[model samples]
Target: METIIREDTPKTPYVKLDGEKGVVEIKGRSIPENSVEFYKPLIDWIDEYGDDPKDNTIINIQLEYFNTSSSKCILDIFKKLELLFKKGFKVQVNWYYEEDDEDMFEAGEDYQSIINLPFKMIEMEE
Candidate 1:
């Protein structure tokens, strides 16, 4: 599968989906006007990657901020990964939040509670 690389824009986040490395990264801000449209390809890519996934998959998310719609789109991505995990694949989410950002930390915690997968809450320096 081909890797998906999207640079961050004012209303979108940077995304890198590397099937070879089994790594999915989403960074920066995600506030797209049409969140679903913006994330559809990524979600589809995850679905495709699930077919012949690597032994271990790591998702690194380091978002400065995101709108509610983007949050749902993110959850959709996680749901895809959760399916992979249920199939006995090694999948993990590394949610990186800046130190002292209570909202971001809590957001990660919320996702951890909702998703059936291992999540590492990483604190980065602001």
Candidate 2:
């Protein structure tokens, strides 16, 4: 599958889902006006990538902030990854949060609990 890359906007995150590289990264803030529309293509890309995923897939997420709607959209992305993991793909997530950002840390924790894949909570130094 071809890679999916999207530039970050004022209300969205920068996304890089490279099937060849076996890496996925989402950084910056996520507060798109239309959460579903903003994330649909990304979610769809993952769905297609699931068919013949790499031996190991690493997802790195470093969101400065996000809104409630974005939270749900983020979950959708994770769920797709979870399915790939369940199918025996070696999938892991690295959730990065700035040090002292309790909210972001807890949000990562929440996602870790909700998703069944391995997750590494990374703290970025201030």
lDDT of each: 0.96, 0.93
TM-score of every prediction relative to native:
0.99, 0.97
Clashes of each: 0, 0
What's the CA error at residue 75 for candidate 1, in Å? 0.3
Per-residue lDDT of candidate 1, residues 1-126 (tens digit): 899899999999999999999999999999988999999999999999999999999999999999999999999999999999999999999999999999999999989999999999999996
Highest-scoring model, TM-score: 1
Question: What 10-residue stretch in candidate 1 is worst by lDDT?
Answer: 109-118
lDDT of model 1, residue 98: 97
Per-residue CA lDDT of model 2 for 1-126, tens digit only, reads: 788889999999999989998899999999877899988998999889988899899999999999999999899999999998998889989999999999999999999888898999999999
- Kindly report which residue stretches of model 1 are placed more than 4 angstroms away from their true locations once superposed: none
